[model samples]
Target: MCNGQRTEPCNVFPKNQYIEVGSSTEVVCQTTCVRGRVFWTLDNSPIDESLSRTINSSHTVLTLRNFTHHSATLQCHSADTQQVLGGTTIRTYSKPSKISCMLESENQHGGVPEWVKCNWEHQIISPLKINYTLIYEMPLKPKTELCHSQETNCSNKSSSGPIYMFTNATFTVRAKTTAWETSSDPYEIDPYSMYKIIPPKVKVTVLPDRLSVKWSRSGTYRICHCEVKYSKVVSDGTPEVVLKKTLGANESIGSATIENVESCTNYKISVRCAIDKAPWSNWSQEQMVLTKLNKRHVRLRLWRKIAAPEESEMRKVHAMWKEIPSTCQDTFTYTIKTTPYKDDVPGVNYTDISCDNSTCDFDVSHHAHRISLKAFQKGILLAEDSVYVPATGKSLPQVTGIQASPLGDVILVSWKAPVQPVSGYMIDWTHNGHQYYWKESKYTNTTLSGLLDKKRYNITVTPLFEDKTGRGTQAIHICSRVGDPGNVTITVDPNDKSVFVSWDTKSQEECSGTVINYTVFYGTQTGPMLNVTVDGTRQGIHLKDLSPDTQYRVYVKATSLTGTNRSSERLFKTKRFDPRLLLALSVCGSIIIILVLSLGLFCAIKWKKFSEKPVPNPGLSSVALWTSPSHQKGKGSFQPFDNPSESLFDQIYTEATQKTSTSPLATSYNSNPAGGQTEEYTEAATVVAPEEQNEKPVGQRLCSPGESTALLSSEKGKHSPYRSQSSVESPTSMSNKLCKRVPVKQLEKSTPVTVYVTLDMFEQGQSR
Candidate 1:
């Protein structure tokens, strides 16, 4: 009996886990009942029942041959039981696999053949039981044709797979499978092809008769060979090939030479290249180049001539040429045509011309040919004009001496002229180069004055002609003295107590031998004068014993053989005095004393008249002594004399007054008393001291002979000896005495004392 309970189902080949479109794939089925039949399906449709039975026995393996997108779902199941035991379902996808064909030949073209074989492999493990069809398409058309497998045997085992078949045009091949439901990638079938080949790029350079070629390869090719071609264009419009050379592949650059080319000519050149021994590329655009010719053949020539009648006559010539053609190999020829004449006439002796090719010398000395011609095709010329030759033997004169004179404002210069006279003379001189001249003249001496001192100058003398032509020799060189000495000088000579003076000579010439003596005239008063003569050649003389402090006048003269050259007299004062001024003081003293004494005598006479009257006394003594009558008669009554004290007082008063007087005689007498003296006395009754009475001389008193009383008797005895009295007394008394003693009747007039006075004067005159 069937169990009513459900049991676990087995897996169905894990649902065919990993599948691809073009490669083989497999699926397996597992069952719960052992030993039963199994079947396979695709998308729920039966594929094979017998195959699924193998799966039930644990041997189920299902594969789809050449599977494609249409065969996505696949299944395997058992057949005995209606209940699903174990089965597998598959999901399919389309992938493009190769659609291939084989080539019959590399040159065919047009449509493919009808029997072309095509085959395809599958990606599922099960064999693909689907039918496949082959399609072919041709170039330049959209139409396609399907070849049946039965008719063309495209799937036959004996046919080659997918062979390209083209009758006359190129074709494309494709295959389509039925059960797989997919198409393959298209393939092209061609028989022949073409490729572009470019020639190598090239460069060419040209020189004076040679050419250079270089090239660079491109487009995946290395240069295998190279060549250069050159030619000349003939007159017939055709090229004349001149150069052709082949070079190795390794040599990308080369050069070639063309010799003996004409000057200023042009040439044409071309270059080509090859790769791995390929055919030479067409000549590269027919490149053209040019070459230059040499220009080194040149020459030159020169000439000169002279036509002086007195001097030698000569002519010189030279010639040169350049850029000669190389084709002319011989020596170059130069021609110099000359026609010489004098005085506008072609003379017989001066019209000759000749040439020597070896020396390039053209001489017209033979007087045969009338012209000279020379030619040079190569090399150089060697001829030049004759150099000047100077004459010899010339001389010049020497300069001897020079002198200058000092004349007020002008300096006179004199020089010894040369012995031999020249055509003329030129003085080349410069003063600071600012005032310079080359003076041409006939005289040798010149005066240049009014020039400042300390300036420099250079002077040169040369003999010249009237045409300003120099003798080519210098005479001498000289210069002026810059500074000179001025003209005044003074000299002095010391003589005894006098000064001698002299001056410099003033004449233009030296002084002669003769000289004049000098004189000195002097004085102190208004007109007192004196003269002194100097010795020969002496300028001054002295006056003997002349007073000091005196002013003097002096002058000088030069007496020569010619005349007297006397200078205007000048004045000078002597040195001031010493103690010698005392004599003047003494004379002035004597005059002043005489005037003072006359004044004093006038005053004394007036005073004597005023005091001539006797003075009276009113008072008398109280007591009187009487003598005996007989003694009184004998003393003559003793009458008292005028008061002797008063007289003595008068004498003392006169002496004191005279001592203080300003009178000159008084002063002189007081200073020298013993020089003159006199004495006088007067009668007076006086009481005297004993000392004073002793000092008095015995004979100084006067006495009366009849008086015999004591006081009166003493007085008479003093008067008896008057001749022996002392002489010391007042000046007034002495004068009175002398006056009285001499009898007025006997005084006689004496002669006045004689005195002399002298004065001196001086005069001074200004000198020019």
Candidate 2:
């Protein structure tokens, strides 16, 4: 820093060289000079005097409320020094925008746009981390690619190639930066006037050994002349003869003839066009043509006769050949003739046979034979073949020891081969109405399937002689039944108390005859047997209503046309119920019920006794009553009834009778209506000996009627709440007169004169 007194010093605030728009900042310029005067300017222009500015000591402050266009260079100067002291360009770094792109014609022919050139303008920075993505769009397809370039001399790759073209296609370029992206409008170039000429169309027709080709130009390109190149490629590396033909200018369509083309040969023909002198339109797309194929003569090749196992005395021979069909085709027959070497049998010496197909088979006689084959087409002999058959001294092997083992469901048939070597053996079997044949077998044993389970079958095996040269040629036959069916499956229905039985059937090979039906037998361990029949198509049957909780043995038998076989029986136990336990529980419950009832009965008896009111003890309850208006009291003997009918007297009498120790006391209670007198008395029945009681008192007064108060001695210690033991006071009865004391003895002495008492006498009195 220099002192303005001798040298000037100028400075500016906002030391940052860059600022963003829409931001407020304070700029200050300071200068030490002869006078304290400083000012600020933008972009080398003097600041507006009207704009807000402050004056300080040797410094000026300029307040920029906000930066609108911040790309200005801020300048600070001293008025006294008359020079600029400092300046800075405040880089705003706005986002990129306003992009533009166009196609360059550098690599193009006339009026053709080739390479993609793009132009973009940005306010922020040039050569900015700018990446351009170009979108090339065409009908039905749009492809995108990325490129990086600055604002100048930037263009994409050329579109003049076949796969890539600008015609009818538009390109859009977009620029991307760390901050923003902007895309330019789309641009396209028309290729109609461009130099790229579309390939012409070619038509072809084929004839015998020749191809006729016609070519025509497409689009608006005028051709001065056209050349057609015709050639065919061949093996052996030799150049094929190529024919070329030229046509005059203005001839858009022309025909060329290619002759001498071998049958079945393919040829390629192409035509190219030339403008007034421009490059020949890329050879008009090549056209391919083919001539018709020609058929030729036939050839026959016969294979040597190989011995077959299943053939009779004659050896089997096969002949095969190929024949090329002629253009004018006709049916042909392959003929074979067998000529025996020995010529023994007249008819078998020379046997000629013919077939309508391509292959022919001949059976040579027992001896060494000669075979001849010929192929004839349209009555013309095209080829012939001869085969010589040699006979071996050995004969066909004898099939012996043929046996069949019933292997559960399948039947295994095995045989022993004859000691002498033979070609092979054949086995044939019929099962379940189906016939099966096996020939040319290499193994000694074979297994058969689809047999009826546990059924019988018969199968036969024969050792075949290829040339009838064997001494013994008897076939081995065996008849046997299939093994028992597979294990019987037992299913028990717990709810229905039934069992279901099932088994697998024998294989077809084991039992070839029809399986009539299946019989299922089931029963409990100690019960009668039960059986069910199932049809041939069914293998299982359900037996319902069977005993529950029982053990059973079950077996399944399948019967075929041959015979019936049985499966192993299965032992099954049904569910069990414990009757003893249930009976014990019932008895216990009954016993408990009986005990409860007994206790209830006992309580009822006690309650009945307690509910009863004690009939005043006969001895204690005593009273007197008059019999009639005469105020006379009568008495009668009280007889005890063994059965009383709801009465207190009967209760007292019965009580007295039961207690013999107590005095045999009886009380008769009676009441009279007229006197309203009630009388009651207790009598002691003393069966005295004749001397004890000489007389009985008929009527006795224990208390005088005048003594209204009937006094009783409490010394007895017996009482009824109704009557006081001391005395019962009441009005004296009118029958106060004394009654005669007639002795019972005198009465009886007189009553021996027969005194009769009736049931009406006891009904005379009433008691309250």
Candidate 3:
């Protein structure tokens, strides 16, 4: 109460008061018995509603909003009494975020196999208690394994005794947190594939005075070291020291050169690799290479190396010999011989051109010739050029019909050889910025797999005749997976019981390889199902014989050699139409279309007639058409009840008619009810109500009779516009009446709820 007077019964309604998160509650408080500002506070903090407050002569409304976690004490204070009038409390809660998963391999000590671990991580559990649950997916199995250690570290290693061992199949796990549980995305691991590592493959190429051996290994395992052993294949059984070389962990697919090796000496070489602390891999198969041969060598070449002209006869030839092979220091004996370029019978002619000289020349008739010369020391044969005649310079047909298929991590290439007899075909391709080619012996098809993904590859197949390589047929492709089909649509044909489905791949460049085919799984619910596979060259299909009015669920799966991708499922209904009804509708449709055309023609004939009617001017006022003569703007605008147009607004717009007679200003002013309008603002002050003398100390001036404000105290029979003057038994009379209405607004990531708390009203000293 303010100044010992009752505050208009000051009834804080007896009901449940609930406050919702991020919402406003405007408590329209009318303090007609008191004056001055009504202060508001929440949680002992002054309410700063400066932007949303509304004030009137009799009512002061202070809006309160709960947004900062929803718990606060709201109150209205009477400035006159310096006391709390009413207050309430609010409350709210928030949910949590998602969890994540990771899979990693931890190497084991001694010689034990590695272990595969699945680790889960989640953070966001402050101000609340949270727990977790984990489950692992088993490949080709009906049930999943509920992990025992849901805390942090989990594994499918042998030592851990996991539910399932890893294999060629995919392995994945899922996890979630408690108390508003949120599931994590599936996690996958490739650790189970470690056993598939292949033995190191070593190939050797013999060079003069040395042998170059290159070896390569496969699989995802990290190689710790590679050891290679090489030795000469000598006939003696005596114990001989073997040469060895080692490559560090950073080396794979590398070469090693063995020096100090004699020419024409066959050497055996092999390689092996191992991971850290694990068992060494099996040694590669023994390979052989030969070093440079002993004794002096000779070479012969025809001057102006081109083959002799068809009509020409004479040709020039030259010969050169070496004593130490690489140096022009000493002279050696030379013998020249001739043979057909296709045959090696070198006894046709022998010219002993020896005078401690190295090179000699001669001329002869050109007839597809071969010239061979030798350096002999005491009749000892040394090195010889077996196939070094001039090239035939002949052209061969190109290999054609080349095709390349890139699977997930592999590429398969094949080609058709030309009709001409081909000795072999050379397949060429580039990968990872490196060029590689291999020879196939007259094979029509070939495959290359394990291509790096997202890489562009160009392949060429060249047909070879003997030593000649011809022009190659080329094919190009990019390695990637076919993406999901886009915009798959299902349409029904009512005239025929069928469904047409369509979709597009749009960009062949988006795929790692070509999309070869499409498989569609579709059927009516709980009815017979049919699977259809279509050629990928086409993008759509029409499925006939489908039952009418049936609901079918269909999805498209685009397939490539690498993998398959399925589109989202679509549900469609087949239209059922009776032939008779359809014919009737067709006839009616034709009639309607004809009627529309006829109506258009009639309107064309009536165009002049319509023009003959007076057209309203755009400049004319539109309001004149709605208003009656009496309700016109200026001529004593009539009330809606007085108009006779039967407009819907007859009762809604109940404005009174204008007054006919003018009265004196003083008379009109005196006729006003609110203190004759002259002293409306200068009314007598409010009065005080007496309480028990024991309520407060005596002699205290709680209220002044001269300062009492007037109240419009009216009886039930008196009129009132805003309130019901004659009221029945009110629902508010019961204790169940609600004092506050709260709305809840929550962020998309969180959920909020309403909480109710009682309002604690405070009283001031009752001064008597």
Candidate 4:
């Protein structure tokens, strides 16, 4: 290899040459020694052997085809010994094109040009240095070389003294190298037509119904034209309404008046000028000015901060406002008048605060406050504005998807629109704990400029409604990055043996360079470390197949164009069970328990009713009243009435017997008012057959008026001709007692029967 250095010569001809780019050339390699052979190389790389041919035993010709390189060195070597023989340098060149020139003048009073700069465009760059000369011709002078340099651009810088304006001039650029020279097409124009005017310094004065603008003359030319542009300044991302007026020429300080401007409003004003038919100059730096307001009428956007109530129920109200631009000649002071609100109604008593600046702090009761501020000059009120502040602001939906990015020298913040109705948004930012800057935007995004580099800033965006302000979302940002990101969060999902890892990555604007990748590092307490890699776009990742019920440490590392950053380590434990499954089991167990308790209660109630004896209803049987011991003398001592015809049982039996007398098999004995037979008497009465009746002795009846009477049989659904005989004797005069016996059947054949007797006639006889 040649190593790009010169070597001993082998008699190469045409040693140095300059060729146009993309053109071909040829060189000869020769040696005085007989039968010598050689090879060629370009830029230390072997050239194709087919491009070279032997002219004789001691000479060779090397051909370069389609030479496209800007510069290269060609070397020849001895074929047999491979020894370097000779080398030559070849370079490509391109003629400069599209040459242009412009005259520059910065004098507010401009007649002569300050300097002239001429430049040319080159399609291909050349490695060899090229010299450029600016040639120009004045209106009445011969052509001259204005400036010379080894760069594409050359400036006169008053090298030929001051050039007169308003006259024609010709400009041309000449480019030359060691082996080639060329000149661009001549460009001609009047110096005044090409000259650029300097923007004028502008100042504004407030007028009662207009704005007076004055600007220093841009140039000495009398035919110059100047325009003053002014617009109202608004904060809500609204386009300004610009108004322009022409300034008079020939004046050292040109002046223009904008009529019918708003009262007490901020305006942005700028000025630009042009001489004759030349292009207008760039606009001057914008200036903020306020228009005069009518006395006693002022508009102000007022805001307040209310601190938490003290133990005495008094809250501190810090009221602030933007400094008002004063146009009045008299000095003024701000008066803060506050009225406590009772259910949103202004109170009768008003409190006044003495203030001289844009802010005032005072104590107020725990009530809504109605505050008003007035500007007073020498005891006369010049302007007044009021604002109503509630104890608690209305809650509104917040913006979503907030993002902050750097764009050039400014930071841009954007967010998704909120769910609630909104009129605009308020954007506020602060560096450190100092005063904050605020702006209003009707758009979803806004730009925040003029930030200090490498410092952290807190930016907050709050939504605004027609009647209230919403809560704000805050974001920490740095205009310039000082270090790598260091915040990470981890969550464990035990059921799936996984964990979720998330991290905060600074935006490209906040970082020194773009972020390219992210890595999550995790490990169990005593296990080997594991890692998962993902791209920078992914903010979170799920690390699966982890050991449950184990402690693990995790962290995230970010790789960016600037460098790598690793977050602090965090420890977390995986749960033993799935929370969702546990919750479901608990709910199911509670339901099952409730169901079991309810069923058990129902069964207990049913079994009690099934196992207990059924008591007959007293209203149907009269057994409770008749079977009492007070009505009985002894066992079977109760007696029937002496006259069977007057007895209620005898009457019912006689009536039932007469009716069923025609049907010997009749088994029903019922007394019902609705003409329907009642089954309640079925077990209470028994019918006697005619044969049984005839068998009774004439003087010995089964139940005498003093003996007990039993009307029912011992078997259910069975009748017998034998009478229920009662042998107990009652010696008392029971003939006066009007008593009746109600028969009750036994539940089982082996159960003894009881005869109950009611003393209805005894009570009636005693009353008589």
In order, candidate lDDTs are 0.40, 0.52, 0.49, 0.64
Q: Which is the leading candidate under TM-score?
A: 4
Candidate 4 structure quality by residue, lDDT tens digits, 210-317: 888888865654566777777777765545544444444656677788876766777888888776666678888898987776553454555555567898877887
Judged by TM-score relative to the true structure, which candidate is superior, 3 or 4?
4
Q: Write the per-residue lDDT of candidate 2 for residues 1-768, one digit (tens) a residue.
A: 234564656567666544445667777666544364556688878876555365766666777756776467888766666667665556454433444444334431323435555455545553347676656666776565534565533556654433233346565666666644666566553433233333456788887557887877643435445566767645645454544544555566778787766555667777765444334556766677655643232345343424553456656665444433332234666777867655555664465687765556656655666667787657777578664455655444467776776655566778787776765555555443233333246677788665645444556565544543222222323334433333334444332266666667544354254567888888878888788887878866677776767778888777775566677778876556445566899999999999999999999999999997454443443332212223222244222222222111111111111112222222122222432332322222322212212253233222333332322232124321232221122334323523221112222323112111111111112321
Q: Can you write out model 1's per-residue Cα lDDT over 1-768, one digit (the tens) per residue?
A: 121123534445666443445566666655544345667667777775543325334456666555555345555455665445455545454433454432222222212222333444434333444444566565565434444442213422213333332332332323234333555556554422111123446576665545565655432223345555666533645455545555554564445555554444455656654444334544655655554544331222122221222334433322222223434434444445544322323563433233334233343432222233444335444222211111222243544454444333333444555665556554444445334444445676555554433333455454444222233222222233322211223344433345445555454332233344444445545546565656545533434454455555544554443355555555555544433355687778988998899999998988987887433221222222223334445553432224333221111111111222223322221222332452211222122222222232212122211211233434543321011222233334433221111111211233422211111111112121
For all predicted structures, in order, the TM-scores are 0.17, 0.25, 0.24, 0.42
Query: How many residue pairs clash in all the candidates, one count each?
Result: 63, 21, 13, 4
Best by lDDT: 4
Q: Quick one: ranking by TM-score, best first?
A: 4, 2, 3, 1
Instruction: Name the regions of candidate 3 deviating beyond 4 angstroms.
Output: 1-427, 431-450, 454-456, 461-498, 505-520, 523-551, 558-564, 574-768
Candidate 1 Cα lDDT to native: 0.40
Candidate 3, 359: how far from true, in Å? 37
Lowest summed lDDT over 10 consecutive residues: which window, candidate 3?
A: 649-658
- Please give the lDDT score at residue 748 for candidate 1: 23
Supply candidate 1's per-residue lDDT for 209.
49
User: How does candidate 2 score on lDDT?
Assistant: 0.52
lDDT of 3 by residue, 622-710 (tens): 22112333444555332222223222211100001111121232122122234233221111111111111112221111111111111
Q: Point out the worst 10-residue segment of candidate 4 by lDDT.
A: 759-768
**lDDT for residue 656 in candidate 3, whole number 0-100:** 14
Model 4 CA lDDT for position 693: 31
